[model samples]
Target: MVLDDLGSSLRGTLKKIANAVHVDSKLIKEVVRDIQRALLQADVNVKLVLDLSKKIEKRALQEKPPAGMSNREHVIHIVYDELVNILGGSRELPIKKQIIMMTGLYGQGKTTSCGKIATYFKKKGLRPALIAGDVHRPAAYEQLKQIAEQVKVPFYGDNKEKNAVKVVKDGLNKFKRSSDVIIVDTSGRHKLEDDLIQEMKDIFKATKPDEKLLVIDAAVGQQAGSQAKAFNDTVNITGIVLTKMDGTAKGGGALSAAAEVGAPIVFIGTGEHAGDFEKFDPARFISRLLGMGDIKSLLEKAEESMKGKDAEKTARRLMSGKFTLHDMYDQMDMLSGMGPLSKVAEMLPGGFSGKIKDIDMDDTQNKLQRFRVIMNSMTDEEMNDPSIIRASRVKRIAHGAGVENRNVKELLKYYNMTKRMMKGLSGNRKMRKNLMKQLQFGK
Candidate 1:
């Protein structure tokens, strides 16, 4: 969900070019200026933005349109490629059986990220062990132990050990034979200082980690770049993990920093759960940033979160217009696996995130629980065909579900609204066509 603003702002600027057939100097100038403004406002470096805009402007004016390609399409393609280039084309963390050191400032979610990364590797058929070298924080060791328990991975830490570097060295040797990836969670400072830097350098020298990752809070905004620089000064950072992206609008700032430091974002933390992490995908990311639906990635995330044929069946029902309250409940369960509602909404087209901005999306769990209780009280026929539930049935069902009759009525009302909305969308061919177009081109 990082860089959520880029999609909407970029779309607005590109729409101007789409409305014009011939690329004129004034149009090119306006487009460049619009891009510059959006990128700068999003906390992108000024020099980077200017350089990108200049390249786009020059290419738009000088490049000849290819056969069968319209001038608008050519310009759009150039912009997309240039933007992707600036974002650092698709890259992945070099996977191997080696030690990985996670370093960041305090409260940047390094502790959580280590477990998530371990979980990721485990899913890839590798054994991972967590090394808690963060002796500075009182509960850091226990936290890593709990996470390792939840993830069912091995952990090495000593609450009694004061020497962080020694613990890391010991953890590495102990877990080297049994684990494919050894992740060491190092200590962090409230602010960069000599002692902290020297301690980190010592840990690095002791472990000689194959990969050094900086776990950064997406909410840090423009400070993310400086933070990355500060850590990189002491230890080489191979990649970055942007944490708390599910809850931050300023996540775009982290992307800007990654771009500035030429570090590729290898992972993102969507939630607190160990399984709530995902590999960063550039195309899908750009799609999300432009307010264009990343349905492919959405489906993939859903599949990763949920298991069995249930998700595929649900997808079939949604596409076939056979979705029901029962289906909605099932979808809610899957959504829980997909992470937070805010994250899911951010992947929708036309910046649908704004609509639920004022709503408490976190109540999704509570709402789902209540809905399930209400649904359980309904008759088998009512669950399948909710249309027959008259006033009497509503009251009786409400009593059985241990909720107010009004609550049952509200659920029915919601069911009806969803049914109607889906029905309308199913019947609207133009709407579907337009949506697909937007998804393909970020229009």
Candidate 2:
């Protein structure tokens, strides 16, 4: 939910059109005003917001609806397209061998992003390696080494070395032969300092990186533009990596950071998990933020998260009214393992994602964890046939789970809710048929 405020507010603003019989000048003005307020509140640059709003207003008023499109649809298309252009365009990291030099201010998550970038490339069948050239930060080498381990990629660093330059040179020679891409993590400063800038320049000259990415934290808000400009001037950065986009109201600024330097945000870090990183696409991102959903990213995540898991078996069991608590626990594990719930929720269509806003995700996620604990305490027979559990069994389970009896009741309530919903949906043969075709479990 990057720029969560804008998502909820903008969607609401757009929904105002649904009640209207026509997309008139008055409706267009109202929508534009709402868009301005949403973007400004999200910490987007005031001038930029005004410009974008103006363009949206002009286009909505002037552009005729294309064939088979209604006036409302035309206006929506104008806003969507304009927003995409303001944010970014179709830009990508090189597919060929590359050396990526990561540079940013202190505490910008550059180190973690290095691992993310490496993992992204490795997943694309490239032999990737991480080079720890940030000799300034204490334990920087160790931190990146652990990340490289987590991502299952090769790492080269010299913890004992004092000169960051020497570290980069050695790491480069070590990884040059074996790796397809060598991502170098450089030093950072609390503020832009002469020494830090010079260090980055030296790293740039030494590595001759294909992409010098400035990893800016999304919380920096509209100030991100200035930071992007400074970094680009120093090392001539080629792209941006806006990190910690999830849960940040100021994500709008980070999304626009590249606009200041004529660079593109190449990737975005949605969550802290290694698997949470995504290749940023302006069109898909704008679509998701506006509650239109991103089917491509959704399908990609599904394939990744469900890999080697028995999805076919689960689907059959669910349709058969046999998805027991044990199966529920397994399903929870799969979802939790995929990434954060908010990220998964955004991939759902507008109709469903809108409803999810009413849910307290934190509470729901906590309940999910509690459910796991309660299920862990349950016996195999009890989990398989929850209907057999009586009051005494519930109390015993609560005691074993170290939770209140009421909490156990809540878990049961959730389990039953899920059961009913699944049964209701499974009852529709056409629904089952469509879902099976989409999942293509055997195919």
| Best-matching candidate per TM-score | 2
Worst 10 residues of 1 by lDDT: 434-443
**Every candidate's CA RMSD:** 23.6, 24.2
lDDT digits (tens) for residues 1-443 of candidate 2 = 66677888877776665434556899999999999988888888888899999999998988766644545556777888988988866678977798999999988989999988888898889999999998876689899999999999999988889899999999999988999999999888898899998898887888888888999988887778889888877778888899888858889876875665677888989888787788989998888888755333333454454454445555556656668888787567444443223443454446645655545565676678888889888999999888888899999999999999988887786667556545754677775665555556543
* lDDT of every model, 2 decimals: 0.75, 0.78
Q: Name the runs in model 1 displaced over 4 angstroms.
A: 19-23, 281-284, 291-443
